[model samples]
Target chain A: MSPRSDTPSSPSIDESRRGLDLGSDRRFLAALILLGGTYVSLLLAMVAADLFYTTPGHLWHALGSPEIRYAIRLSLLSCTLTTLLSLWVAVPIGYLMARFEFPGRAFLDALLDIPIVLPPLVIGLSLLILFQTAPLRALETVFPVTYAVPSVILAQFMVACAFAVRTLRTTFAQINPRQEQVAMTLGCNRAQAFWRVVLPAARPGILTAATLAWARALGEFGPILVFSGATRMKTEVLPTTVFLELSVGRLEAAVAVSLLMMGSAVVALLLVRTWSGTGLAGVSSLRNG
Target chain B: MISLRHITIQAGSFNLRDLSMEIPTGSHTALMGRTGSGKTTLLEGICGLRSIRSGSIWIGDREVTNLPPGQRGIGLVPQDGALFDHLTVRQHLEFALEVRGWALERRETRSQELAEWLGLTSLMDRLPAGMSGGERQRVALGRALAFHPPVLCLDEPLSALDDQTRGEIVAVLTEIRNRTGITILHITHNRSEAERLADRILHLRDGRLES
Candidate 1:
């Protein structure tokens, strides 16, 4: 008896096998593309719904309200201050984390991550609890950080600075330490080398960090609400404005504020992306050389 | 003179031990060693870039082991030139003078003189990325010499060049040595470089120096 194949070995079968192979190769990719498209489309749809929910005239009128106007100005001013203060802390912390070996260095690094990982409401609660203590409470009597104008800026900075420090640390690490070393070898003191060489080299990272911190501060709601409370024309920021509008059953006003924030975020992201893309390209070329 | 007295440094897994050497003022000394034999570590230790675990360093009657690299008055030309990517050749030369608080006119004249001396006058406005390997090395050398440092440390300065370019750099080094009479502590693995450039040869093996 001759050996026999169990299945038919035909030309059409071979062609069908090739077709199946191609189909299998595309299946995972097709699934991924569909999933990604669905996610992006959902986000775009939500934004579109907000944009179309209110008439342009209603949005303009809502934005023109004195309360809304105050929220906008407060948000812009507090966020700007938060960004500057965050950068001031972030630069030194980032530099030290990147360049130094100190006692408790690992612990300090992990500590910096707490704000980013912790719930925003919890951060607010922590701040409130700290202010309830002896020294901080005593200081609060003079500074009035609790439920005050300064609290708006403070709450935003508390969260935004963690993000800024993370960004700047990565930036400083990407830079070659040899550049600083070479600068010092050329008769520069440590400060001179940092200002003249490392700072300029890290300009891109700095811009990204500042813009991101500002955007975060602009959108901060939980911490601001818990620490500062939403007072009309006082502690109200953009996010608080949305909450206040929603609470009063003014959905159009809430959507209008949300739309403004979304627009601001988009503009900030665009600026950051453009700046970082150019900055990183320059840094990489220099590093490669 | 540049002097190292029984210096020891630990860098990662490699340990450079008991490295004592002396280069008389205005003389060129070449350090030769195998790959991973701690030549660069020794050079860095002398330049105050690396901390010595023990022993001391001196430059021209001053004990400089405790001084910062800037205070030691030692110039270093690292491997691959290590030029600041953002700075032009002229800026690189002016950086040290600026740190030393040189006036604008003095900085300009010094930069011009060094640029002319290094044949970098034409390349003064170009960034390091736009320059060739030899050109970058020349710029590095000019920057190192801009402050008129008492001792210059060269860490395999020509190892990254083509033979022709290396020859050109060697010529430049010879010219610089003859013209400036600066004390040079050069690290190299090539015997021909040692023969051509060094008045004395110090060979490193297993973290020890043999002169």
Candidate 2:
């Protein structure tokens, strides 16, 4: 008898046994089918139509109205303000989380994430309560904050800031802190190092956060309605106009406003893509190097 | 002169304890050790990047123990030539000069001189990521040296290059030192490169200087 064989004779079987899972073809096929069936572009189109379509005549009338122009301007202005403010707040917070050792840092990080997970409506309600109640209410009386333009801004600021902080913290974490230290050793003081090295290096990531915050603020409805009461011409934004039109059964006006909102979202995305291309390319290369 | 007295640095688990050493002005010292030796830690301590738990450090007459890195007047070319990939070769040198408050005229002149000296005149406009390992290392060295630092620290400067490229860099480094007379603290695990460049050698193991 031949010596008892220990190794399999078929090289294909042995090679396949090394790195291949043998029984997941069906599951893999199922995943691909599910992915194809739930493709995102189709879903976006369906949701966009449902959210935006009302009556064509009202839609056209709303588009031509001067009030719509004011709404658009105010919406863009407020969202821009919210984005800039969010970035201003997020950078230091993100860098601290990335590069420092401190007390209660983990707790603070967890707390920052809470707003992102909570419904925007809930956050709005909570802010309203805090501003209306005692202690906080007393503080607010010294600085009033409910159902005003500032309230709308405040609500946008809160949610936008939360999104920015979370995104930026992750961005900063992905960078090596050694780069800043190296910059310092090259005779740059802390601020100089941050400006010259850290900020430039973190630009792409920061831009990403800003883009997200701005878009989120632009599309915000739940928070603004609850906090600022959706007053016409004072705190009414694009989303609120759509909401108002829908509630009043002005179907075409609602659709038109929705289309405008959708158009702006597209424009925002395009601007982000174009603006971040070169900066992110440089950053990604540096990261790889 | 760079001096460390009773320096100790604590990370999560490894502790570099009571490490005392000195690199005199205009003197080249090579730090040689096995893996895990505190050679890089000592360099960072000298540069004031890592905090010293218990020690006094002086770069020349300035007490740099607690000072920030920029105030220490030190330049470090880290391992694998950690050049900013987004910056061009000329920009790398200019950045150092700019940070040190060099005048515009002096910045241009110094960058030109360094680029020519490093054989980087042909590649000044190219970004670091597009450069070869040797080219990147050369740019990094130039960036560090452009500030005219009294002392320069290098960590495994030639370890990432091929044999031919390593030879070329060693030649350039030797020429740069001969002309500038800048003090060099070179850290490497390679005995051969250390022997080629070092005027004096410090053999360290587990954060302690070995005889």
Candidate 3:
């Protein structure tokens, strides 16, 4: 009888198993693609529906409205201001949170995140209540805060600043503390090291934080609705424009304004990527040494 | 001179108790230790980067026990250089001088001299990311030495380079020692390196020092 041929070469066994593994991998990948493709198709369908629902004529008419024009101008100005103010506050708070170990630091960290986790309308209500208090209420007589133009910016800032602070904190945390320590050893004082070494390293992160704040401020609705009251040509931002148009039963105009807001958001996100050449949220990526 | 008298440092649950050491001026001493022997902790304590629970640290006859890192007048080259990524080599060399409020002309002159001495004159405008391991290490050394502090501390500065680059850096280090009488506290685990560069060797095991 021939030598037992049941135990073939080990290489043939491995080759057959390898072929089976390849088939299994293909099936696994196919399942992943099928699941992921469904979500992507849903997103595409939503965008397609938004485009198909409104015409260029409606968009042009919405743009032609003097009230909408004024809303656009005010939205731009307030969002820019909110972004600048948010950065000014965020950088120092972020640095302290990232670098220091003080008493009640964990408590403070959690407390700072309240704006992020709180219900949107509650923030606006809280602001309204805050302005009604003694000192602010006294000041309100001289400088009106509640239900005013400043109230619009203030409401946007309440939510936008929390986002800016979170971004900046992560940015500062990613940077190596060694460079700051080395700077001190090389004759830089604490403040100088932060300004020269830490700040420069965090420049990309600052830009990202500012972009996030601007975007958040632009889309802010519930706070502005409750705090500033969406008066046409007074406190109407893009989101409020959509709300006001829908309230008047002009679905076409509401869709038009929503499309415009979407366009602006896309442009802003593109600009960030174009300017930094880093993908979204490249916080502390540029000078990570 | 660099002196540590009865120093006890507590890092987490590990304790380095009553460790004492002395290095004379213009001498190179190597510190040898196992992976977790607290060599870096002791080095940080000397440089004022970490707190020591007890005892005193003195540098060049002046007690720097409570001084801040910048006020200590000691230069430290941490592992792998720790060079600033955003700055060019020239900027790094003049960093200390610039921070101390030196005039533009003076800073330029000193940085130029240092660049030439470190064989990095051609690479002045390059950032740390664009350089070789040896070149970056040279820049690090030049940066630390630019301000001319009395003491220089090296924390495994040569361990990251290849064999030939290591040899080149060793030669450069030997020259640096001969030219300037700066006290150097070199940290290394390699016995051959310790024998080659250090005048005296000190070993650390379980946070205690042995000659």
Candidate 4:
């Protein structure tokens, strides 16, 4: 080909390529949208189905029911308690696991994962058996645990805490270790450095761990069912309320309860997201004071 | 005076074996070494961040070999200026005093003095994340110097800076050295930094000092 005839200006070449690029880009976008949209659509569809099946009246009626009201109160109480307890146990374990290297560290790490990997029902069964041991049996006489309110919190904590610990371990690991070292050199002892430097820096992670623990505790069913049992106005929680309603062929009640739990979850998530976004509202006072 | 007598530091598989050196009081020294030459391990041993396997570390006349880092009366400015992200410049300067149980009024005065000295008075309320590299480095220096420790250890402190910023920091460091008369052990790869700031320079090759 002749150079003048065959060769084109760079702008002309870019213009031609732009035409093809637009079509390809549109197709690529469509494929990605379809793939991601499919999963989101499924979720939307299920939620829509729940909305379609239950009315405002059904939610009100479920709320009016004495059993569900008890379930709501109990669920709120136990989930908060479970979250508090989980954070207490998880933070120390997470810090130690992330910051130190010792003999049997690997073994201890594997042991923590057993709750996450084990079947929930097995955890419930294990707890039931644990309570039967001589020491726990002796303590049981002082306070009833199995098939009681305490059992509800215990069951939720067993699984929820493992999740909290895992999240916190990752959270603490991501923070700079140099900060703590610097703190120690600044005349703060090891514990003081952790309290002031390490913990304050790990605010986001603590929020995440607490949220995960709360959410996991809210949805827990298998362990609660196995150990606490579904009783009316006593050991009954929201999950059990759903199970009891469904077993008795009250689909509307179950659906209403489900929506209630979903709303609570959304509210909890939003609260945390807002709190975290706001820099935890006076970090300087907390850290320096 | 600071002294390390027959010190040994074991860092995993690498070891700085039986090294010994002396840093006279009120003198700033620069230590230079090739990569992976155990400069950091040796620095950590002196600051009590890492425990020495054998031998003694003495600050003045007291044997401080067994003391914790907090009790050793030393200050550290690691590379990258590890300032706490959640604290403001004022908080950073006041941290050591706060932890040491200084009264609130005393801490405020000390932080104000440091802010004036380091030219950080304009950044008192600003968090570390909002600061420039040079600014953060200055804050780190203020934090190290806040409690007025007798010894200061700098680990590759000026390696992460542009030339102009480096020059400014070098000037600030020189001012600090002259004014405070505190002993400093600065680790760096830049010969000019050593020439410009240090009273004496030492080199580390294969874990032993070459004066």
Worst lDDT 10-window in candidate 4 chain B: B127-136
Candidate 3 chain A: 10-residue stretch with minimal lDDT: A1-10
Task: Please state the Cα-based DockQ of model 2 relative to the true two-chain complex.
Answer: 0.44
Candidate 3 runs further than 4 Å off: A1-24, A271-289
Instruction: Report the lDDT tens digits of candidate 1 across residue range A107-192.
Output: 99999999999999999999989889999989987889989989989999999999999999877776667677778888777788
- The recovered share of true contacts, given per candidate in order, is 0.53, 0.55, 0.58, 0.67
Q: Which model is ahead, 2 or 4, in terms of TM-score?
A: 4
When summed lDDT is taken over every stretch of 10 residues in candidate 4 chain A, the lowest stretch is A1-10
Question: Model 2's lDDT to the true fold?
Answer: 0.79
lDDT of 3 by residue, A38-149 (tens): 9999988987899999999999999999988988899999999999999999999998888777778889899889999998899999999899899999999999988889
Give per-residue CA lDDT, model 4, range B1-211, as digits (tens): 7899998888878898888889999999999999889888888888877778999999999889999888788899988787888889999999999989999999999999999999999999998765677898899999999999999999988887888888889999889889999999999878888888899899999989999
Q: What is candidate 2's CA lDDT for residue B163?
A: 99
| Model 4 misplaced regions, further than 4 Å | A1-29, A271-289
TM-score on alpha carbons, each prediction: 0.90, 0.87, 0.90, 0.91
lDDT of 2 at A135: 87
Per-residue lDDT over B157-177 for candidate 2, one digit per residue giving the tens place of the 0 to 100 score: 888788999999899878877
Candidate 1 docking DockQ: 0.42
Every candidate's DockQ is 0.42, 0.44, 0.41, 0.38
Instruction: Compose the digit string of candidate 4's lDDT tens values, residues A1-289.
Output: 0001011112222234533345648888788779999999999999899999999999999999999999999999999999999999999999888887777888999999999999999999999999999999999899999999999999999999999999888667656677888898998777999999988888877987898789889999999998999888989999999999999999999999999999888877886676454433323222221
Which residue ranges in model 2 land beyond 4 Å of their true spot? A1-30, A39-59, A134-144, A270-280, B60-62
* Candidate ordering by DockQ (highest first): 2, 1, 3, 4
User: What DockQ class does candidate 2 belong to?
Assistant: acceptable
